[model samples]
Target: MFKVLLGVSRWNFLSLTVLTIALAAVTARYQGAEIQQLQLGLVLLLALCAHISVNAFNEYFDFRSGLDLLTSRTPFSGGSGTLPQQPAYAGVALLLALVTLLLVIGIGLYLTWQLGGKALWIGIPGVLLLYGYTQYLQRSPLLCLLAPGVGFGVLMFLGALWALGAQLTAGAGVIAVILLLLCSNLLLLNQFPDVEADRQVGRRHLPIVWGLVPSAKLFAAFYLLAYLLLALAVWFGLLPRFCLAMLLTLPVFLLLWQRINKALQHNADLVPALALNVLLVHLCPLLLLLALYWSNTATV
Candidate 1:
């Protein structure tokens, strides 16, 4: 049962939340904000619960909608396949979703109480996206494309800044936009292999609405824009020099782009592209986090 719950929640994917939250914390530190250990811990718990709730909800809803059975499971895209295999545990998945959502609400409310109403600016939309993403938002192509990025980049990242009492500096805003582009592209590419399955289930994501080739092109454009923004931010002194470490992934990005183009152009396998997308999604933030921490520790 424990293992099943973990599977339904996509426990391995929760590390993305950890990386995001850590990046926010380090960014706050870089900006000279004093981090409170207790508040940081609560924020981490809140983010984790939010992520778990979304994953479980997605698992239950996809299974209920028959999308789970239809999808060709992949390492990056498709449903987690837990409920399809363990149908009896469908109820458990729903329960876990609800319970985790409630926990998210409780923690969010507490943080709002301590941090003031500004937290709601991030919390309200986060809760909405968490609940509506797999169902309602998935029906709108543009909304579906942008929702994941908004949730992670704007809400989670900026909300962490609020909790840590950090000012929303220009550099942070640039970082947020970079994250937004990366995260949106992350979901965009993952939707490729699941395009047919998602369409059958009435999901109107970019891949479904724009078709794979255009969607692939958009994915490439987004990544290019994100890297350009990163370079601009550093050049303009919005981000530190060490943040340039992210450029080290440029070769990998080029390879990923080639793989994605090949997969789309020649109907080649997409697993490698998907894997590289996930790696970049995680790696970019991780490198930035380390860079921010290093900047904070370095003496001027």
Candidate 2:
């Protein structure tokens, strides 16, 4: 039961939330905001609970819908096959989802009361997305594509900044947008291997609605736009030049772009491309986080 809960929560993937909140904290410090350690910690907890809730909800819904049975599991795509293998634990997954969701709501309410009602602007939509993603958002091609990005980038990242008591500067906005694009593309590419299964389950993400080729193109376009946004933010003095460290992933990005088309046709290439996409998603934010922390410390 414990193992099944961990699988449903995608414990390994929770690091994404850690990186995002760390980035937000560093960005807040960079903007001259004094970090409130307790608030930041609570915000981190909130984000983690939100992520776990969504993953559990997804696992339960997909398993109940029979989507997991149809998917050919991959390292990156497909629902975690935990419940399907241990059907008795399906109720446990639902209970975990509800428990985590309640935790999220409780933490969110606390943050809002401590921080301000403005927190609701991010929290409400975040809760909605968390609950609706697998059940409803999957039915809309555009929403399905953008939901993950928005959840991680805007709600988690920017919301963390707000919770940390930072003014939402232009630099932070640009960073959030970059994460939004990259995170969206992360889910976009992962969908490639699941296209058929997702379609069978009535999911209409870009890979199904737009076809793999066009979806791949959009994936590339999103990465290009994110990189361009990073460059532009630095050029306009919106983000510090140090943030350009994200460009260090350019080689990997190029490799991903080159392999995306072939990945559509070859399973051999698809896994590596998916791996690279995940690398970029985590790497970019990590680099930016380090850059911001360095910049903040350098001045003090």
Candidate 3:
């Protein structure tokens, strides 16, 4: 029982669900209401199951690609878990992912029947998005950027919102767009450290495609664009102008940027490499939504 529980990707899987749900509660509260605590719990549980499945399947696929062995694997191979170290059987990991995904599908089907096809539309796209990120577009340049940002961010947010029976408002759209841009840079920030290992393994992420300096610049550009988009969203009144309060996280982002740049300068890629997995796969979404939760709810 304990081992099975441990197989669930602990940090970000929980973090993303918790933070996303918290953000939903805050969003509802800001509109002067509260969601049922029971419904929120169910929504979170469902999201966590989906995240766990995605993480496990990612490990299975990466191992299948032969990227996790022969000195080519990044120390922090995203949130795919310890497959690289052979902590558990690959078939077992895949089994876990399949079981969890099927569970989510069951829950999603019930939700569709309960909430009508509206919820079904979002849930269906969401599962496909997860599969695409792992089995297909994960390595593709244009789509890869959206995997971390939009896939995990906006989609997670929308999942919670849908679970709560909320409609897709302009506010939600704005948040999703902003999150996509931020997540893209966050992904790039993570890739810097693994450039060599990934290159050695034929990973060919943006860091490798553009080389170090250019990659750094590109990553920075995404961060800058994210900020600008946030500003524009505020100015245009899509999201609440006050949502920009999350900008306080800029210092942390700046620090990460500096660390990534310096590591690239030196060939000691360990920090960025490990940090990439830690930050991108786990910490970035956790902290970003966490900050957003507080910022979006605090003044209310």
lDDT of each: 0.89, 0.88, 0.63
TM-scores across all candidates? 0.97, 0.97, 0.80
Query: Which regions of candidate 3 deviate over 4 angstroms?
Result: 1-13, 71-75, 78-81, 196-204, 270-300
lDDT of 2 at 15: 88
lDDT of 3 by residue, 1-300 (tens): 345335434344356456556666565554445678787777777777877777777667767776556343443444444665554577777787788888888878877787888776678777887566656765676676567776655767776776675655666665666556665665566565556656665565666777778877777777677667767766876656556765655776677677766676775654554454344433433443454455443222
Each prediction's RMSD to truth: 1.6, 1.7, 3.9
Q: How does model 2 score by TM-score?
A: 0.97
Candidate 3 backbone collisions, by pair: 193-273
**Which residue runs does candidate 2 get wrong by more than 4 Å?**
265-269, 296-300
Top model number, lDDT: 1
The top-ranked prediction according to TM-score is: 1
Q: Could you give candidate 2's per-residue lDDT for residues 1-300 as a string of tens digits?
A: 789989999898898999999998888888888897888889889999999999999999999999899988877888788988999999999999999999999999988888788778998999999999999998999999899989988899889888887878788888888889988998888888888988887888887888888888888888889899999988987877888999999999998887876755665558888888888899999999898988844221
Give me the overall lDDT of model 3: 0.63
